[model samples]
Target: MEFINIALSNLPVTPENNQQPSEGMQTGLDLKEKLSEKMKMAVEHDFFAGIYYLQGKYGHTYRELSTSRNLLQQIYREILEYYIDGTWVLLESAAPIILRTQDAKSKHFLQLGFRDLESSRLFHQRGSNIGKKLYTNQINFYKQGIKRVRRARKYGVLAILESRTPVEEKKEYQYVSYDEVRNPSITEDVKEYDRVLNKMIGLISRQLVDATIQSSTRGYPLELDLIEMHQDNFGAIIPDHPHLLNRFLSEVETAKFHERQKLPDRSRPSR
Candidate 1:
C-alpha cells in the first residue's frame, strides 16, 4: 500500500550515511503522535456510545457518539491543513523533499474517521423505532465525513505532486517549478499515492453499498436515497475515476435483484 510505502520511506535510518531527519519529517511525527492521542479518546467515547446504544439509552448514545464523531471531524480538518501546509513547503523548497510521513498520517486519520462513521451508522440502523429525522441526520453526517476525507486525500496528492523537482536544478533555483519539470521518482510517488487513494475510495464505496443493502433488508428502504447521496458526495469528488462510481452502481443493482428474489411471490393466488 502507498501508505505503508510512504511510512517506510520516511523512517530515520542510521548515521552511517550521515543522513538526518528533515523539519517536515519531525513535524509529521509530532503531529501524528498528537492525532493518535486524540483518536484514542474518540475511540473510548465511541465504545461507551456503543454500550449505551445496546442498553437502549439512545440519549446517552447521541451525546457520547457525537463527541466521538466531532473529535474525528476535528482531526480530519487538522489532517487537511497539514497537507495544505506541506504543499506550500514543497512548492518553496529548493531541493526535492518527499513529505510522505505527513501524507501517510493524514490518510491514516481520514481512514479512521471513515470507518468510525460507517460503523456508527450501521449500529444505529440495527436499532428499532429509529426516527426518520435521526436516520437522515446520520446519513448526512456520514456524507460530510466522506467529503472531508476526500478533500484531504485530494490535498495529499497535490502535496506529493508539489515535491516533484529535478535534482539537477535544486542547487540553482530557490523555488523549484513543480509543473515545468517532472522528476521520475516523484512521478512514481504520485502514481503510488493515487493507487492507494483509489483503493481506499473503492473500499468505502463497497461498504456504502453493503450498508444500503443491509438497511433495506431491515425495512429502511434507503437504497435509492443512500446511493444517490453517495454518488453526489463521494462519486462527484473523483471526476477522473468514473469507473469506481460505475462499479458501485452495478453492485447496488445486483444487490437489489437478489433482495427482490428473497421476497415471497405474491403473483400466486392465496390458497
Candidate 2:
C-alpha cells in the first residue's frame, strides 16, 4: 500500500519533459521485462506459502487445483483492474484507478490481491529428482521446492497471461507497443514497477530467511559448498537448469581455482 502511494506521487505530469522516443521505449521494455520476472518470483513464493496455509486450513488439494484452473475466468477482470488501479494507470489517467470491486467473496478480487497465497496447492505429489547430481550427500528436497515454484508459476501465468496492462480503454489504446513510444509518463511510471518488484523481493527474502531459521533448513549444510565439491569431484553438470547460463558457476570456479593455485604443490610430498 505504501509502495502504491509513493509511486503515484512520483510520476511525471507530462511526457514533453521526458526523454525522446527511442530511449524511453528501451527503458520501458527493460522495466517491463524486469518487473514481470520479479512478479513471477513473488507470485511463486506466494503460492508456495499459500499451500502451507491451505494445508493448515485442511483445504482440499484438488479444490485448489480447480481454483487455479478457473482463475482464467477472471483474467480480463484482473486486466481491467491492473490498468485502472495504481501508479501504472497514471500513464494516461490524470487520476489513479478507483477500485470499486473489493468483495472478499468475489474470486476475481481474491486472485488479484492475494494471488500468491490463494493459488494452487503446493507439492501435489513428489516430483522427479532433477537436482540429485547438483548435490553430493542425501538428495535434498530443495528440488521439491523448486518444482513447487515451477508449478506455481505455471498456475499464475495460466491465470494471468500478460504482465502488462493497458494504458487506456479505447481500441487503439488496448495495446501500446514499446515501438509506438509516445509516452514519457511511461518512463516515470515504470520506476514504480521497479520499486514494486524490489518490495516483493524484499518481502520474499525476509520470509525465506525466517522460514530457514524456523525449519530444518537451519541445520542443513550450505548447498553452495556441496555444489562446489560435486563440481570438483564429478566435473560440472552440463546444463543445470537455473544456472543454464553458468555465470555464477564460472565465477565460483574461477575463485576456487585461483585459491588452489595459491597453495603449494603437495604432490612433492617431502620438501
Q: After superposition, how far is residue 254 of candidate 1 from its true place, in Å?
A: 39
* Residue-by-residue lDDT tens digits, candidate 2, 1-68: 12221211221122356655343334334433443333333333334335646567434444433343
Residue pairs that clash (backbone atoms under 3 angstroms), model 1: none
Q: Report RMSD (Å) for each prediction in the order shown.
A: 20.2, 22.2
The C-alpha stretches of model 1 lying farther than 4 A from their native spots are 1-20, 92-271
Could you give me the TM-score of model 1 versus the true structure?
0.34
* Residue 220, model 1, lDDT: 22
Cα error, candidate 2, residue 61 (Å): 42
The alpha-carbon deviation from the true structure for residue 173 of candidate 2, after best TM-score superposition, in angstroms, is: 24
1-271 per-residue lDDT for model 1 (tens digits): 1221122222222234667745434455566556655555666666667767988989978987878766655454454444333322322231223434343433444444344434433433332134433533543444444344444334433333323323443345456578655762434445544454454355446452121211122222211122222333233322322232223223433343245338687987889
